[model samples]
Target chain A: MIGTEIPVLAVLCGDRRPPDMDAVEAAAEIRYTDEKGLPDALRGADALFVYDFLSTAVPGAWHAADRIRWVHIASAGVDPVMFPELRESDVVLTNSRGVFDDSIAEYVLGVVIAFAKDLPRSLELQRQRRWQHRESERVAGRRALVVGTGPIGRAIARLLRAAGLDVSGMGRRARGEDPDFGTVHASADLVRVAAGFDYVIAVAPLTDETKGMFDAAAFAAMKPSARFVNVGRGELVVTDELVTALRAGEIAGAALDVFDTEPLPVDHPLWTLDNVVISPHMSGDFVGWRNTLVEVFADNFARWRDGRPLRNVVDKQLGYVPSGH
Target chain B: MIGTEIPVLAVLCGDRRPPDMDAVEAAAEIRYTDEKGLPDALRGADALFVYDFLSTAVPGAWHAADRIRWVHIASAGVDPVMFPELRESDVVLTNSRGVFDDSIAEYVLGVVIAFAKDLPRSLELQRQRRWQHRESERVAGRRALVVGTGPIGRAIARLLRAAGLDVSGMGRRARGEDPDFGTVHASADLVRVAAGFDYVIAVAPLTDETKGMFDAAAFAAMKPSARFVNVGRGELVVTDELVTALRAGEIAGAALDVFDTEPLPVDHPLWTLDNVVISPHMSGDFVGWRNTLVEVFADNFARWRDGRPLRNVVDKQLGYVPSGH
Candidate 1:
């Protein structure tokens, strides 16, 4: 039975609010607040929308979400929102899944091409006004291992395949015939099979089993000619092991978009590595992305208000939207 | 009828000779010469191979080629050998065509992705150890106009289209349908249709009629956001006009692998432009490319020896291998 009183919606925002907040205002009373004001803002809210996906205030203010029946984050990765209390609660969780797929896929392809063509070396030479000519590798016929079978990883696999790469995928389960990836290898066999590929890409969701998955052993297993790319969560890789691998030439190069710490401190050793390409976690953020994220939230909000099944509802035990549903 | 006499082959080389000159030694009497030795070497030669494609000695030595029957260049472009003396002569001309097609196409796709993702900026920021994150444009759905429709250009068109770009082509004539390009626009209509594209790529062969085609007017006609890429001969574009276009913001950027002058004088203004990416004319010179060139010439030599029709025989009148031939 639905309650007769008007439902309350709370939005946790940072300096910037979600675009077009008016779309949800008519359906529910909205309470907007910063990280510090989250507790008071969530006191009577029945549904919480995490507009500031980077904030860690939610876990601390979980006690105030007394009336909350659902929680949604404006990002594909829901790691920050999967706190112990929330996972133990009856509240449903959903994430912005489809929004970043194509954008991230494009980013991955860009970096892959960059590595094969040695674009970074060209740029470095450009800075010195040098006209040095070097032979570049062809991406066509090269092998790539995509370390996740989720939408983002699937998108990356498809784009890479389209760009003439022989691509395979690594997922929770092994399968022989996937539409995007013909062979899906189990994540457990990553180290054993990693040597066969020229490019290894990680787009896995962050979970207890996945944290620090790319350690020294995995790096040592990769061929010296291989390139490692991570557009997934930073904690998914062991940063020190990667740095050591790059220093020792265990891998030819790496294109990292995420790190354990944001803004990857200026003093970090990875900054000085010639073969490493670092991006500030902006792989999926294309122009007008913020507006699109807001629209996704509003559409989901309408469904919640009408008591309909939400899109992209996460499976708490699995820590992500499962393959089937 | 095949010639009964042993054919004399003159090889115009610089510092390096063809990798396996022994392969053709059994078929002909080989005379290896540098630019200065070309005239003496060409005397009484039945065929001349321009191993130093960069050398301009062929025209000067034309007076000594009393018995020369065929001239083959070790490069796709036959600009150096297309002089009045040779063009008016009965000597057959062939190029190392198919060898560089895929490599050059890969380079074109690399620059396109670099421009779309602003990888150059990312590298520059990396140099400064800055962690600035900027939203990048997606290459998918972006319109690209390939300026040439030969093998190299067709390869680029197909690869770019596969990578999710909407690709079209510019050729001598317009057609509603082409296997690689859905619509082939007339080269004469470049300015009129140039504005519709996000990228304008030049892979047209260097010929009298096509020289300096991408002038100020052509640059001005392009969208301000468009990027220009040239993997063709340098003289296909007017260097000064291109500099003006880039300086005045008529176009967003340029990736030039070929320039009007080899070595691109260190003082050239193009080296200073933040938006320009200058590579030293090595787009198609992949590893072992010289060996492949030798192999192609050897195969063509065998066909010549057997009195059979040869592959990649250029139509001197039109300056390239015609599409249907």
Candidate 2:
């Protein structure tokens, strides 16, 4: 049964058909529209789902809202969507933090296997009608450092370990013990830890502290055979520094799924590098992803209706502060 | 303590410096040389370790005095090294079966992920400096039909299942209850079973029965989105038929590690297909693989000394008859 005091929701997204529509409908009186039309829809809304504001200019309508008490983002990272007005508002903010963990983790494993097994070279050989036999590295007994102890990082660690890799995780703060991870270290020790591993995976959320985290120094610290993989926010890595690392052989290779600039310009030098694998900020895009989003939204709706704290609530100070309990 | 009897050994290989020289010496009297030198070495040897040989040319070497009692093959497949004379002799033949399982399994998983994530398209987009966000198929819920329930096949099945895939294994005989695999089917039902799976992996040994196993009829029965992967012997698949199927889009794509012709002649058209991935039988080569082989040889040597039946004994009639016990 619909609650008597149904919370009104205004969805501001590029795609209106988010998989979590049923949950949104069950939790509140939801109205879906593009970001351009969001201001009109937010008039009496109690909550809002935002996605469109990341690429395009922020709409003035969101700033004028007084009735909207909560804002939930469909993405794992909310740095692009965060604005001065929204930050200053009393509205509660949340995000889809744990949803893309397994999908992105699987993508990371794919790239690692590709690089280690010389798959790209094999493809090139096949193109030339050449059968070349070459020895490739194995994943077993290799060291991996996962920089981010969130769901995505944990999932990557699990898969890597399953493949017989020795994986270590680094997070914002070192926990005494973690059931899901091994030897959790503080973020401050990431560069030192990076030097010891054959592969470094970045799955941390974007924040002021994480911005430019994988810069010149970080790459310089990695082993000459090490490969870097970023499935998190783009700004966390400095692209220019990464390009230099690939060209100079500071690191063996790199696979990037996110970029500081979307629709990377046609003339960018990164396009020409042989050792880099670039994707269109889409490591988490899997078939039926929309439906998965809908499921998360529905579950959150049930909690909202029951007057219980919603899951995946973002900390106002840090954004996506994973639950401690 | 050393054994009272110093057993004579014949090592027939292309390279004299076998990686397991120390282990070989510790086990028995070692006579190391290439295939051309095998005849002279065979006169005094009690056991033989053959890496490569000409089956038609080396018939007499297997029948020298019946003193050469045990034959150990360094490769997973004994086809190239196995002679008809040796098969008919009273010699015990054992192979390095489990040595390459993990390495080959890693390669299979790599190709599977590469196809599902549309990695080829991503690589092209990167080259064109385009940011195209497309939804990729996930391996999580996909069904895989592994044709060959050997160690390599089982290893591949385990890795695929760990990534959330539903894997079915097929073998020579259908077991009513096998706890290790899901839905074990007989090889005769391959064409019917091929229609429903997203991935078909062939790791069966080369035999008269398996020759031309994945032909035009098999490809025609497969789903349009299905992919074929062969890590087994090359003769098991018809190369021309595979080329035709790929060109006609009868199957989505294929990754081949072995070819009917080694060094896959420079002019073969199979190399030109963008959908196909080809490698020159290096999936089993990994760092420290030689050491693993040595360990296997050492364990087998101890068993042979104790008069225990060997682990990977190949059945002369059936060839690689799995221990029903």
Candidate 3:
């Protein structure tokens, strides 16, 4: 049953195990393995299904991808899969794009409202059993600048707009009008755009143009009362500049789901900064996400079975899907 | 001048001082004072405006209400003004009901999303500089039961619906159909209704019928995974029962903005419970709220001067605005 008119998939997952593949099993010959067994399982596979995106096994197992024609990652971010060899190879790369839109939007809303309403102080006071009443900020009529025009960023913009925040968005270039964000701004205008917004959120991808975009100049351009959020890749920001901004009181506060260094070393000063909120790069993961992950893969598998052009294909050199696709 | 033909108003405020009353100063004689000076200030006044709602001066100053024709409190809850003499007096009573609607809705959204997304855990992890990624619960498709059909409660329901919650409301009785809440439920069926909802929020006012409504039986009726929120008065719940329910894990968690005691004792057991979140009764407050309070009172004052009926007239016997105008 080497080829047998069906594609063979090497499914690599984490300790929690891969999702049930019963629905897609009939169309593909799937062999399940943890990160450790990935190299052996990938030997002679026609496709790679990386269910556990955090696994570091893929780059090491690259040489063993004998006949693999395609690789699909069960995450929106392709940072873990951006191996030099894999990027240079002829293999097709696809991602789970729409799966996390709503959940991440909700997460961003949570952080925005938390900062606006001063929930942290409330929780702190609760722990101490102090009944000191304080005024909270209103979410309505506030201004926001979301930096990213991708699905996830747009979703965040939509929810914030619905909640009554005056919302605008920024992309690589100022392009077409978005139903939710209206005319997106060019990333170059960030410094000028930064001054008026009460909230500046970075959800752009990690690329040459976007890396270090949120530098000292950008932070300095923002209002003193403004807040910041990063749900995008960590490299999109200049970490030291952000820390300096907080220390100097250049901005009010920030909630970062991603950082310059992924496990942000224990000794890092960002850990102790009262004005910064640190979340372990988990704004996208939601309950029962694994099931949805498997469902997306299965949908793509059915398309691949009949020789259909795949959805969510990443342009290898560009590192992500092109705009307006 | 002591008993002038022009209407004299008594404005009682707190440490933040009275809101800017330039608009009303030209039309009416405004005498401003804190709790200490209110008794004397209330002398020969045509109207009383309790701008500093927290000051216990209103009750003490009630005996000196010589020429008082109308009283307007700058808050939704009338607990501070619900004194024996004021209740028995024939003077008109009105409150700033609609002013706090949107702000309290946003606060409720903050608490709901904070609990679902585990932002507290994120903050805790940040303190330790640990980048441990964890899955969070989604807000979409979650079921909610919002108690109280007043503007504040309905506003919460509308926003929650936009955020993708299946929301139902309960009023004094279950007769009419609400566009936002669909068919409202009877408060008597709360125990039965509590079983299915993921979130049970209390925004009902303090009243004879609603006092201590959420006791042991109500908590026991809820699903083990459910979360409770109280934006209503503290006396609406049995504090000891809520503490015991949280300890027994009958419900997953709770967030209380109002408690049986204004400054809940530092040694209260609820403070030590990890499953409960406590906030001082400031959910309706926002930045510049003092201005809004003053504006509401000023609007009512203009109406009073024109010999028109006041808005937000409370049904004293029932303790809140009854259904419809």
Using DockQ, give the best candidate's number.
3
Individual DockQ of the candidates?
0.77, 0.67, 0.77
lDDT of 2 by residue, B1-325 (tens): 1257889887776563567567558768888766567788888677777655223234655445347788777778777645677778888888888889889999999999999998887887776778888888777889998888888888999888887788898899876555546788899988887898999999998877888999999999999899999999888898899999999999999988987887788888877788988899899889777677767767777788777768788887767747451
- Looking at model 2 chain B, report the run of 10 residues with the lowest lDDT sum: B53-62
Give the lDDT of residue A119 in candidate 3. 85
Binned by DockQ into CAPRI classes (incorrect, acceptable, medium, high), candidate 2 is: medium
Query: Judged by DockQ cut-offs, is candidate 3 incorrect, acceptable, medium or high?
Result: medium
In the predicted model 1, the residue pairs found to clash are none
When sorted by lDDT, best at the front, the candidate numbers are 1, 3, 2
Off by over 4 Å in 3: A1-6, A23-40, A323-325, B1-4, B14-16, B26-38
Off by over 4 Å in 1: A1-4
Clashing pairs in 2: A19-A290, A19-A294, A20-A294, A23-A298
Cand. 1 Cα-lDDT: 0.91
- In the range A1-325, model 1's lDDT, one tens digit per residue, is 1556788888999677888878788778888889998999899889999999988789999888888999999999999998899999999999999899998998898898888878888888887888787988888899999998999998999999988999999998899889999999999999999999999999999999888999999999999999999999999999999999999999999999999988899999989999999888888988888988988888888888778888899999878998766
Cα lDDT tens digits for candidate 3, A1-325: 2334767899887566666688778777788888878888889998999988766679988888898888999988777788899899888898988888888899888889998888888877776777888899999899999998888988999898878899999987886667878868899999988998999999887777888999999999999999999999889989999999999999999998888776888888889988788898788889888888988888887777767878889877767766565
Interface RMSD of each: 1.1, 1.4, 1.2
Tens-place lDDT per residue, model 3, B1-325, is: 1333578888887455665788788778888888888888899898888887766678877888898978888888887787878888888889988888999999888888888988887876776677888999999899999998899999999999888889999988896578879878999998987898999999998877889999999999999989999998888899999988999999989988888877788988988888777888888889888888888888888788877777889877777767574
